[model samples]
Target chain A: MMRLRELAHARTGDKGDISSIAVIAYDPGDFAFLAEHVTSAAVAAHFGATVRGPVERYELPGLGALNFVLHGALGGGVTRSLALDAHGKSLSSCLLEMELPDPQAPPAAP
Target chain B: MKTVRIGSGAGYSGDRIEPAVELAEHGGISYLCFECLAERTIALAQQARLADPDAGYDPLLSARMQAVLPVSVPRGIRIITNMGAANPRAAAAETARIARRLGFGGLKIAAITGDDVLDIIAAAPWKLMERPDETTLALGDRIISANAYLGVEAIVQALAADADIVITGRVADPALFMAPLVHEFGWDMEDWDSLGRATVVGHLLECAGQITGGYFADPGYKDVADLARLGFPLAEVRADGSATITKVAGSGGAVSLRSCTEQLLYEVHDPARYYQPDVIADFSAVRLAGDGPDRVAISGGRGAARTGMLKVSIGYRDSFVGEGQISYAGAGALARARLGIEIVRERLLLTGVRTSELRCDVIGVDALHRGPGTGAMEPAEARIRVTGRTDSLAEAVRIGNEVETLYTNGPAGGGGASKSAREVIGVVSTLIPEAKVTPRVSYQVT
Candidate 1:
């Protein structure tokens, strides 16, 4: 399986206590697989306790990207959070560690 | 039908100054925009104004003007900026004053104000969206400032009046880019699709160097060239609201599809509905194409009607943050640092110093990932950081004192000890009716 870092690059933004991370594919051809596999549930599970609220994913087919808004994720936002990366700037790189479907695998998998 | 080449000069208040000089010197552009204010910067500036009447604008305002004005003024490049922070009139006056010193006699500077609604907000029983329980009346003297995010109308009006440079208070970041597009292309304020497309261009150009590969480089995976002298971004916006993102040729960094895509998603929440004062831009339909090296063209942005209310950022006195750090090196550094943290924790409890929240982290060990710490291998050194949020300044100073005392009373070989206690400015959001605020542009001719 290829890591999400190989297929996509992401950036994170914070508003209040929420963090929005956007993942965009390097190649337009990989967009379909990323959009299908990288669901809100999957992203939510990846962050786990790092997020206190729900994770919502918005699809941008035109740009071959997915936007994930993680609520209650920034502790108390930038002004208050004691987190080293309080704005969740480094969190995007952590999300990039997500495993993706390997291109060399079988044509279809359940 | 003419295209406007606008270069982004400054992304934030303290961004590098040399890149702007590079843009002004070599980059051929009509207008250069600098975005300097953050959510809490104005509140801090308000505190500064309270201390000294003539010091509310950006501290580096004169320095940046000195660095950029000489090269830019003779080149006939107009400037737009929110470097005004808490005072646009003062910033505008200062820019004109600098122009006179630099012998630019024909420069006209405009200042946009009326974003400050502290009186109106204090009159009503308005509660901030973030703090539903706390009303404006309740905040009382702690309220430092409340400024609404203005749109592109005033900025466009300044440009229309032949102002060489436009300075504003608090404005929506994208609106800074959108104002030029509106003034150049004569695009209607109510045209959602075109406005939406223009907003995309503004958003792409808003953060100076991010779109040009300054913030996107990875060592082995995503390599970028000459990041030290990285060039800022420029957009060639057309009459139809479509634009091409490119930088000065032979400059550092690059403008590729990956860089464009990453910047497009920066600070953006929902792809379909990005709430701007002018319009709700829909970037879902936007497409990106690489025309040539260091060039990316973006189009197909859709927009909805403007929102009835505008967001206001209210700043108030929160709590105080106290921090202390000291490094330990050589044989038993990790163990010594751990002992130091434990002593401070016990000392605070013994002294009955109450903190609302406390965080202790071993810097080299597991501060970021919180994973295995120097497991099998014995490392050279480590640092312990003790941070706490206290209600009072005295209490905050004690938190640092407790840590600093560790150098003498607790740990061995603890060197480079430092301590600081600072006030925290908290920003809350509220919505004010669009009609409640009137953005007015006033200009001075030198």
Candidate 2:
């Protein structure tokens, strides 16, 4: 299975304690597949301890983008967080490691 | 083809001013907008105001206006900005003073006020959106500033009154750009679609150089050229809610679909219902195409009627951050740094230093990603960083004292010790009814 980064790139934003990470595909054709596989549950699980709240994903088919809003992701945000990266700006790179169903390899073992 | 060219001069308060100067001189545009306020900035400005009456507004307001006004005036480019920070009237006066000093004495400036809801917020019951249990007014003694997110109506009114420059305090960031679109096109305020489209353009341009490739560089893979001289963005917005994003010639950075896409999703929570003071903009249907080099054409934004409520950014003195960092080098550096952190951790507890939260990290090792980040080849050096949150400055100082004490306390060749204890002012969000805030604009002559 290929890493999600092979098919897409992501950018992240923070509001208070929450961070919104938008994953945009390199090719518009791969968007449908990423959208289908990159579930909120999966992304939340991937981030694990870094993200402390529920995850909500919003789809933008026109732009082939998925916005995953991670609540309580900033470790109390910049004003309060003692974390080195208070804004969680690099969290998007960590998310790019998520594994997806490799198109070349016959899907996930059904 | 009724079109308006608007250029972003500054994004946040400390954004690069040289690019703004370049945009003012080179980018031919009717309106120049500077969005220079953040969530907790007003509180800090309020604190400054408490210390000095004439120093509440943005520190760079005069400098930016001085650089931009002369160029903008000759071109008849009207300036709109939220550089007012805590005090719009003061900021407008400051801008006017700068304009007069620059020999543009005929410039008319307007300040939109009434966003400050301290009196209302203090008396009325409002709950913090995050911690619903704690009432906003309950933190009365700790509260510093409370400003509502004003909309475009006040800005449109100011522009209609023939103000050459509009200075405001705590208006919605996107509204800084959207106001010109509404005033120039005379787009109906109730028309959600047009507002939505303009909002899209505003969002893209609000962060200044972000959409123009300042923040999109990834080295070899997603390379952006000449980022050091990155030019701010300018939008050629049409009457039909369509715009072309481009930058001035002889400037740095690029305007690509990737750059635009990264910015398009920046800080956006929901793609379908992006809420603002004026409208609920929908980016779901929005379309983007690469019109040419350094040019991306965008359209198809849909907007719905606005919510009756408006967001209020409340700033309060949260706590204090006490931090200390000391470095160690050579072969056994990692082990020494780890020991240093462990000592600071236990020392803080032993000293009975009041701490709300404590964090110990080895900077070159696990500080960022929680483990040996990007270091397959053993690090030659490492740093120990210990930070703690405390209620009082005295307690905060104690936390740093322990780290400084480590210098002689031993950790093997530890040097370059730095320590600081600073007050932390945090911002919280709350919603208030739109009727409570009556945004009114008044003008002053330079």
Number of the top-ranking candidate, with lDDT as the measure? 2
Model 1 chain A: weakest 10-residue lDDT segment is A77-86
Where does candidate 2 stray beyond 4 Å?
Answer: A99-102, A106-110, B371-378
Evaluated at residue B11, the lDDT of candidate 1 is 86
lDDT of candidate 1 at residue B199, scale 0 to 100: 88
Q: lDDT (0-100) at residue B352 of candidate 1? A: 82
Q: Put down candidate 2 lDDT per residue, A1-110, tens digits, no spaces.
A: 78898888889898999999999988889988999999999998887777788999998877889999999888787667898888888888878878887876764566
> Which portions of model 1 miss their true places by more than 4 Å?
A99-110, B132-134, B330-335, B369-380
Query: What level of docking quality does candidate 1 show?
Result: medium
Model 1 Cα displacement at B61 (Å)? 1.6
Residue B362, candidate 2: how far off, in angstroms? 2.0
Each candidate: what lDDT?
Answer: 0.87, 0.88
lDDT of 2 by residue, B214-239 (tens): 76787765788899999999999999
Candidate 2's C-alpha lDDT? Answer: 0.88
What TM-score does chain B alone reach in each candidate, compared with the true chain B? 0.96, 0.97
Report backbone clashes per prediction: 0, 0
Name the lDDT value of residue A24 in candidate 1: 88
